[model samples]
Target chain A: MSATVHIADVVKHYGKVEAVKGASFDLAEGEMVALIGHNGAGKTTLMKMMLGLIRPSRGTIAVLGENPAAGEFSARRRLGYLPENVAFDAALTGRETQAFYSRLKREPVKDALALLDVVGLGHAVKRRVDTYSKGMRQRLGLAQALIGRPRVLLLDEPTTGLDPELRQTFYDVIQKLAAEGTTVLLSSHALTELEERAGRVIIMNRGLKVADGTLDELRRIARLPTRIRIKVADLPPSGSPAWLPTATPYRRINGHIVEIDAAPDEKLDLLRRATADGSAVQDLELIPPSLDELYAHFLRQAERPQ
Target chain B: MNALITIAAKEIQQAIRNRWVLAATLLLAGLALSLTFLGSAPTGTVGARALDVVIVSLSSLTIFLIPLIALLISHDAIVGDMERGTMLLLLSYPVARWQVLLGKFLGHLAVLAFATCLGYGAAAVALLITGSSFDGEGFAAFAAMIGSSVLLGAVFVAIGYLVSAVVRDRGTAAGLCIGLWLMLVLIYDMALLGLLVLDQGRNISGGVLSALLLLNPADAYRLFNLTGFANVSLFSGMAGLAASSTLSVQALLTALVLWTLVPLACATLAFSRREL
Candidate 1:
């Protein structure tokens, strides 16, 4: 896939503290990538460098095939960004704020105003922003970022104050945009929320890119144990089960529930063995490593010395 | 160019919504009208043209009042945006940083100009309607007074932008701006007064004194209005200085224009280097 954003060895230093330390990554065209990390892990700084709001101390970043730090607006007009703490003049009505951004973007004001309905802010468009709640303001921020049908979107903590229903609506819009070939970068701390939506995730810890891959790939790299559970209609009353595998150990979670721990390679064999006897096992459950687990594992691995 | 106008238009809209325009206009009109009537009272007893005498009084008032008003309106224009996080949003758009600074400066200058015209215009019209007779030269002096008053406001607005660009917070910008007003209008001349008294018209000759007066924008504005015209100068009690002063009207006008440009250029330069 062709890359839309190519970041090479970018580092940003503030006084003695380095916010981003030789970080490197690429975003493919029409890809939705999630940047997950804790607070102060350099997520916002990285996004700012991409937006050309701040210059990096070393290396380079390119957006839409143009150098972002060159202070040129030719590429920026096609890029959209929603800062973490979005702020607007409180006296301006929602519609007025939208109008101003549309003018800045040099697009038709009507087209920008139409985005208000898409973000579910059509009802409160006439009210001043100071009267809107945090969620409403977030939606307005989203509407502003959607101006001019931008080709690339950089959203920081996009779903911070959104309700679950609005969050779903928000992702639906993102999915539609991605379907139209808009490259999206979501920088957030919401791991679970992005696990299903984002095809690729980049986990950061203390300004270092600890892991960058799909969930399944990271889980495989982590090498954590997989869990398998079987519910039996009848519990074997004997001290040991004759049907149980000899090599793998089994523990009893309850009278009818038997749990088995399997390594990554041994997972298929354990599953085949448990399903071989249909009369013994009533229900089976297999739990793979979750993203939260993978995140913790990667953070730990990143801290270890070479 | 379009971006510049759009940003400036937003500032104008903000001023209207904030009631800054109305307040400025009302304040200037009240002060100018009071000065026109109350100041002209001495003219009836002294046998001088009422409007020309009012021009002399209002020129001195502009020296003290316009700079403070300009600073009060513009001191927070840049720093407040950075503090509020709006500057980031504005910069994210496809516009240059200098455009933002220039747009805000133009919008604020327009606001000040509007207030100066309407506020002092009401007094000028009231003087004419009250049957106060004045010739073409007297009216010309009144017009110059209004025009130079706006220029003085522009100078302070530009300085306020410099303070706003350099300071990190609105509180500090406001503090420095107030201190600037004090120094230029009150303290600078007070110190100059002591210097002139000590000089005894010997070491600091009239040429040196005129150049020193040009250092402060208020003094430049005073020389342009109060001393440029004969009738205004006689009534303004600056006849001695006007006769001996070598600084011409054109030079004082150029000084006011430079006062506006130098600070505005500094503000643009300072804001461009800023991280935000």
Candidate 2:
């Protein structure tokens, strides 16, 4: 599939400070990509470049096959953006705010108003935004972003104020949008949340694209250690357990809990040996490297000299 | 065109919802009515038309009050939105930056115009209903005063937007806005008076004097309303200068229009380049 958003060697500098180093990535159509990073890691800057809010100091960024920052307002119709700290006019009601954006986008108000209900804001559509709670305002922000059924969505920390249930609904809406061939680029601090939702992960560190691939692909490159937990009746003799391989490294937690670190390739081998007969291993769990570990591992690798 | 109108409508709605429209209308109407009734008391003794006296009083009032009200409503139009993070989301849509700026100017201008018309128009109506003799020239001068008053407010609103565009924070914008109002409405003439006293009309000719007054929008507005009509200029005590002044009525009106457009254009340029 063709890329819905493309960035090539794009560098953004705010005076002497380089906010986005030369970064390159292509977000495919209908693919949900997660941009995982810490604060000031250039996630917001890169998204701004794609949205045409800022131009790159070097290289180029293309959204929908056009330069977004070149002052062509019509090109942004297919684009949707939700800022990290989105705010609406406080004096206007929710419906009024939605109507205003709809008019600006040249879209019909009926469908945009319908989005208020989809985001579960039907009951308070007429209430002033100053009276709405943070989460409700977030829902209104989401509703505004969803205008025009935009084919490209760039969301920055969209789920910040959402509760667990609202987060579920948020992802559900994202899933539906993606199913309809929308390209979604989401930046958030919630690693586990994106772990289950994003089709691929792009890790940025210190204004650089550290790693970009599927979760498993990143794990294979990082070679980070997987975890293995085994529940046993005894403390596994403090150091060596007869049921486990002697060369493998492990530690005992308590009288019943023991934790083992296994290499990526050796995880299966270690699990098989521990659960050979279920005689010593009452309960067994083989945990692969999570996104959190892989994320930290790639961040550390990027910080190191080549 | 639709986007521009929609933005203007939204601003008008915000003005209504915030009670700014009501306060401005009532304030202008109350003051205009009081000026009409009280300023007309001297008409019988001074041999001036009652409506003509009202026009002069209202024009003087417009020079002081409209700019302050205009600045109060518009000093934060762009910078406040940018600081609060709404400009980011607003620009993410399919609207150009120029459209946002122009839309806001038009909206604020409409609010000012509406208040000016309804608020001051009530005074003209009251004069007609009080069983007074009326002529076409008197009513025409009253209408011109209202028109020029709205134009004066537009000038300050544009100036306010310029402040909003260039400043980094709302506090700084507010400070600069008040300073601009003081300079244009209060201090420009005061400083001109000081210069005239110092020069004693030797260095400053009548042509230079008229050009100097044209520099300040309030002066331009005052010249337009006070001198555009014959009786009003006599009552305003500028009849001799109005007759000998090189600046024509069209020239002063053009100056006021430029005062509104020049700053608005500058603000749009500054806002177009501003980073959200």
Candidate 3:
């Protein structure tokens, strides 16, 4: 598949500080990628570069086959961006704000206003933006970004002020857009929220991209142990099972339940041994490494002295 | 072109909603009506046309009031949007940076023009309603005063944009705009007068004085509307100064136009290079 957004060795320098340091990545069409990073990890800076708000100190960025920072970049109409802590003219009503953006995007005002309903902001269409809550304003921001059916959407900390239900609605809209072949690159500190939705993740720390892959690929690369919990009718007298594999250590949770950490390669062997006879094992549970754990592991790995 | 109009329309809508249009119009109308009645009272005794006196009074008013209004509306144009985080999202669209700056300039200019016409136009209408007699020269001068007033306001608006583009924050821009107003409208003339007094006839020639007057937009505006017409100049006591000075009407207008364009161009250059 063709890359919808390309960044090659892009670096941003604000004086002596390096916001993004020689980072390179390409997002394919219809790919939903989560950019997870800390506060100063260059996430917003990277997104701004993609939107052409700031020029890179080095390298190049091509979005939809055009230089976004060029004076007459024709691809800008096909791009949408929602800034972190998005703001609007307080004097303007929700409908007017939508219409203004629609005109700038050269889209139909009728169609753009329809997005307000999709984002659950139809109820406050006539109200001034200052009267809307933070979440409502965020929804309005999202509505504007959805205008013109942009092929590339860059959202920086989009869900910062959204409630759980609103966040669900936001992701639903994003998923629908992505499924329709829109490339999405969103940055957020909320890892659990993106764990299930994003097909791929890019982890950045201290101005560098530490990891990028699907969840399973990251798991294979990190080699982090999976956890297995066994609930038997009873444990042996010594609180250890005789049939359990001895290579990996096991911890007893209670009289009937015991948990063991199995390496990626040894998970099947450990599971088979635990349920071999079916007489000792009453029930079994398997837990893979979580996004939170993977994020932490990758950050730690990137911080290590090389 | 469409994007430019969209942005400009948004600005006009905001100004209307925020009551900037009403406040500016009301302020100009109130002051103008007062000056028209009070300042034109001596017209009968002085044997000058009532409309000519009104033109002189309103031109002086424009020198002070119009610049302040322009600066007040424009000082925060660029930095304010940047602080509000709207400029980021706005620039992300297909619109160019210069388009944003120029669109806003046009919008604010339109607001200023509307207010100047209606407010100052009210004063002229009041004169006609009061049964004051005036010739075509006086009427033409009155029309020129309103037009030049808007041009003066445009000069300050462009200057405000320059300050807005250069400053890091809104507070700084506000403070700088006030300082600029005081310098150009109040201080520059005082300092120039002092320089002329000190020089007597030793070194500062008429050409140098004309250059100095052209350097400040307020002074250029003052020279244009006050002295450009014979009737208004005779009534305002600027006929002698207008004759002695070598600066022509076209020169003053050119100076005002350059004042608007130079700073506007500088502001666009500055904003295009700005990080956020």
Identify the candidate with maximal lDDT: 3
Segments of candidate 2 deviating more than 4 angstroms: A232-239, A276-278
DockQ of all candidate complexes:
0.81, 0.79, 0.85
lDDT of 3 by residue, B44-85 (tens): 787778898888888998989999999999999999999998
lDDT of 3 by residue, A90-149 (tens): 999999999999999899999999999999999999999999999999999999999989
Best by TM-score: 3
Interface RMSD of each: 0.9, 1.2, 0.9
* Poorest lDDT segment (10 consecutive residues) of candidate 1 chain B: B39-48
Q: What lDDT tens digits, residue by residue, belong to model 1 across residues A1-306?
A: 788899989889888999988789999878999998889999999998998888889988999888876867888889988988899998889999999999998999999999999999999999999999989999999999999998999999999978999999899999899889999999887888998899889998888888998888888888988888888878876454556777667888777888877789988876777678667888989888778878888888988875
Q: Kindly list the per-residue Cα lDDT of model 2 for residues A208-282, writing each as its tens digit.
A: 999999988988888888788889765546567776778777777766767888887888877777678457778
Q: Please give the range of 10 consecutive residues that has the lowest summed lDDT in model 2 chain A.
A: A233-242
TM-score order of candidates, best first? 3, 2, 1
Quote the lDDT for A17 in model 2: 96
**Local accuracy of candidate 2 as per-residue lDDT tens digits, B1-276:** 887888888989999999999999999999999998998876787666898788889999999999999999999999999999998998888777788888888889888999999999899889889866679998888888888898899899999999999999999999999999888888999999999999998989998898899998999998888888898898899898788888888998899999999999999999888775
lDDT of candidate 1 over B1-276, digit per residue (tens): 999899888888889888999999999999999999898877787778998888887888888888998999889888999999889888989888889988998889889899999999999998989889979998889889989999999999999999999998999999999999999999988999999999887898887888899999988998899899999899889988899889999999999999999999999999878876
Best DockQ among the predictions, by candidate number:
3
TM-scores for every candidate against the unseen true structure: 0.96, 0.97, 0.98
**What are the chain A TM-scores of the candidates, in order?**
0.95, 0.95, 0.97
Q: Tell how far residue A173 is off in model 2, in angstroms.
A: 0.7
The TM-score between candidate 3 and the true structure equals 0.98
What local lDDT does model 2 show for residue B173? 98
